[model samples]
Target: MKRILLVVLLGLISHFNFAQNPTGDWYGNLEVQPGVILPLVFHISEAEGIYSGTLDSPDQKAFDIPITNVTYTDTNLSIAITDMRLTYEGVVRSNALIEGTFKQSGLTIPLQLTREAVAIEAPNRPQEPQAPFPYTVQEITFDNKEANATFSGTITLPKVVFKGKKKLPAVILISGSGPQDRNEELLGHKPFLVIADYLTRNGIAVLRYDDRGTAASTGEFTGATSADFATDAQAAFDFLKTHPDIDASKIGFAGHSEGGLIAPMVAATNKEVAFIALLAGVGQPGDELLMDQGYLIGKAQGFDDEMLRKNRIAQEMMFTTVKEHYGDTEKIKEKLTIYLENALEQNPEMIPEGSSKEAMIKREINTLTSDWFQYLIITDPRPTLEKVTCPVLAINGSLDLQVPSQKNLTNIEESVKKGGNTDVTTVEFPNLNHLFQTTTTGSPSEYAILEETFSPDALKVLSEWIIEKTK
Candidate 1:
């Protein structure tokens, strides 16, 4: 998210005798992207003349994260969250103002802290179901014995019972890559919750749960990869099959983004899956897909052709190094360091101001060689999609930049068809973004600003297809 720092026009300077101490709530907005804004607040308290505090990322749902170290002397204020690898350095420009730079990983963005609490209005989501919903919503828990993970989530069933007649068809919702909650909440929009409500209203049962180590789920998420998450989805499917009201033969999955990649992963090996709906799923190899993503997003952000080319080259170097040295982390790190060093030598600007070359290389190595990235870059989705014989509905928006609709959707359809399974449908909706929200440009900058969580047309397509498939 991109945020602009609000300038405090009050030109009042405080006397040295009555300086404003770095104590109390200091609020600021971080423009993470070109147009996206993430608001952060630091609550500093002084005890025995020593500084300590907590941090809040309001939009990201991370609250009260302890600030490991706080150093304030004269007009300088520095805060560090060692666990999160975040740091902030600021100058107390005025009694009520602190001009600072928020640094995390390797990215740095300007932040203007103010004494007054800034009000951030939540995006209006008319589609978010109000209470008195038309279905039965139950807070539930299921266990993944393989991961030794216990997941907490919600299951919404239609009000009508089908005891002795036909059992209700159900779908398990799988979220994209991240620490997603049951609702797969992002940018104030809960697409899974909205989808669950809609499907349940139309007589299909829906189960959605938090990811491992997120919300109520118990497991270590940091080191887990997509292969590990598939077990969790399998657990949800197994749990639903055991439910008296759910049709064991009709259970399926609806996954978005990375979740889209995961749906096929489970279905490919599990014949019990009746069908799967891939929401902007990954069909190409992870490296190629990510390269395309970077190019498209860069173009949307108005990056020059030269810059885009340079970025793509850098990405290729990183991806190739990782793919070539998939299992050997040490080799991967060594090669990545060399590549980064060479790139930095060619362009000193590669290293951000105030950050050392060593620090930049380390951050790059850690991120590029992560368990998830390593698996993703080297792993191909075509083989997985080809193995999925179950009925499939792969859909994406024409304007989706993250996963370019044409290339991915085409690859998905072709791969599935090559497996000699004709029971597949793929649709590319116009004017919709990766989240399927109708937008002028598919840039992520528009996700928070757009009111529509999931398009009515898209929702209807998903619900109707699942109903028809179950019947």
Candidate 2:
């Protein structure tokens, strides 16, 4: 939900001759918070100081990044990289320990650095056999002039057989809200991969890829909006339509979460799209969804009914005011700050009894409070949906908190009907979370611990709907 840069400061002083090379491998650990430590590795040389590094995150693929601006004096050294907006300020102790704080994105997080005395090996995890689907995965890049960016991603295809006797039906997998990889599924479970395998085995081909700025893709992921992401999906659709093995007439799209919003947009312009699947997509404006999300999260965290009501009222008011003054950054910030201050004073116990007003202000301001959230609050998905003429299948999880099932499903159905399309089908899965995993108590915290893949029932519903419609 928030974008943060990781910075590590290594203070190492070298008294060696200038002619001596300053190239070697360095190791360090970054402390984003009291208990959150991220391990990192960087290599420095005299010509470029620190130029390349990798971040150690179990959930993220290892990335290659550049470091710049290295300075050393006596036992103190300072290094900074403007490109990453991070700086490492530290001292080299007599014991050869490099310690400092990594500063970036208007906050200074702590970090410690050390020389790698021996080679450090990456952890070994059991690798599953190649996906059962007869598909080939390859990286591809495309340009998006609307967003002023170029992005890269992987395309998974069913291996050609029988000398391409017939073009295969294809679908593009769109991810939900987050920095998702090409698979769009993780944590020991791959929903897209499962769908791809099932569809491929059934004689349908699939294409899945990383979002514009995630994983191997190139571009800034943080500054993007749902509309921007839609362009990325459109690019992928264009790629598939041109593939030699793909049936241009049978191309379609399937989206999850925010991806659902993108499906209609892509289908609207390309009449050739055979169909669309909206899995837990949003029907109302983003602002309404945010307030609902906040209320749900607050309630699940044990906030009383009165407290929830007050919080929702304040959030709605703030969002409404923001919508009224979209492009005026100064007025928006001033009004938001005043409203947040008043809201805190009204219910001092709303957030913790002893929390300071200043602390609360800082926390609220740090969130998505600017034009992005304002624009999102007023933008509705119905306009795009009405333009879509293809057969539509919209699904929701009854236990979803982010986008309440009843409200979202109602919106989709109403929009489709208004568009003169009576063939829309809606499904609400009981006890299922946003990710379509069946769970009694659904919460974001539960996501990191749950290992179940996308529900088989949900997949069956989708596959059946697509096959039936296309037939």
Candidate 3:
């Protein structure tokens, strides 16, 4: 995700016009990589004496993404997108130019803006559906009674049902981590939306919703752990089963990434679920998975195996120390600090440049104490998989660096089979990333630039698997 910006050229400039407000389309291009340039447009406007704006990343196919806040003085501009962890700072140098730096993910790159006459065209996603009359999309709210939260979402069903059909098979989509909206929108791709559209068009019912405290959902999002998220899936499962047009026994879970880990958690206890689809799910203990995830992604970014090994070892020790002193934050902090200090003393190079050993230790402590990471760091997904007696379909892409295809799929398959689950199928699609997008390299930086949002081939395989198993 390294985006080092270098100016290739500049747009035409115009005469000064200071009295005019900066309420117009300001455009800039971000060189995300060496060859890929992502164009960004900020539509700044004022309403009720407050500044507001929407951002467009044309190359990423993301248009009109809401900017949380945009405040500017007569000569300076400040814009922010809290959810995306992005911020922009600029000063109006002239009528045609606004000099700025785009900050995201700890990188600063020059992103001076130029007034654009024509709008920056967002890339077309041919597969994204245009409304007409194909499926029945119903607004919904399911009660997560266990957690005292209400989830808002949409349920898409095929408009045409067979004459003799008593109940329609259904699938509930669980998002990966973080607070995601119903569409699981990220990196300019709405994978869940594409999946729901394709599945409903093919006669499958799909339920997808916002995470707790996200969008229209109600609850505290950041304070919840993966275990708490499992209950959210269970709640959705219960609600889907109650639908008059749904076959209670045929309702299943289709979880992606961290969501995949949540699927077995729901299925293990909810016997009503008929099947499950695991997309790039965790197949090992969370600590090991984290290590592998970082290592693979680092290697993809040009890190040598020796460097990765050193970092891996260092992290392993920290994770081990944290786990050993579980539930005791004070001891965990003390031990982790000592562990980090020793590691640094042995090799000062281990500490990141411009950062101290103490700061890194504090950051590690905070991470290990978080509700989400603490639970998942040592979690073993197999234990839950063993309890899920329903039919299972686990699939991963060969090029997925986050969840390496071989070990994850193989271990998941083995764990389920050992639990006497003969109704299981596992597959790894060639050359696709964790998001199921076709790419040259599985680096996540390419996700935004790649035109293919979700591979039709992979979606077809998954949709077919779900339909078959549910039937």
How many steric overlaps are in each model, in order? 5, 3, 0
Query: What lDDT does model 1 reach?
Result: 0.88
* RMSD to the hidden true structure, all candidates: 6.6, 9.8, 8.2
Q: Is candidate 1 or candidate 2 better by lDDT?
A: 1
Candidate 2 wrongly placed segments (more than 4 Å):
1-133, 159-165, 185-189, 351-356
In angstroms, how far off is 242's CA in candidate 2? 1.0
- Summed over model 3, clashes come to 0
The Cα RMSD in angstroms, rounded to one decimal, for candidate 2 relative to the true structure is 9.8
Best by TM-score: 1
Highest lDDT among the candidates is held by which one?
Answer: 1
Off by over 4 Å in 3: 1-30, 34-108, 113-120, 342-359
lDDT ranking of the models: 1, 3, 2
Model 3 C-alpha lDDT per residue in residues 398-420, reported as the tens digit of each score: 99999889999988898898888
Q: Would you give me the overall lDDT of model 2? A: 0.71
List lDDT for all candidates, in order.
Answer: 0.88, 0.71, 0.83
Tens-place lDDT per residue, model 1, 1-471, is 123222222222335425677799999978777556788888999999899999988678788988878998878999876545678999987768999888875678899999987776655899999999878888889999888899999999898754454679999999988899998889889999899998898889999999999999998888788999998999999899998878899999999999999999999999999999999999999999999999999899887898889989999989998988898999998888888988988877656554566767877788888898898898789999999999999999999999999999999999999998899999999999999999999998889878899998899999999988988
Q: lDDT of model 3 at residue 2?
A: 28
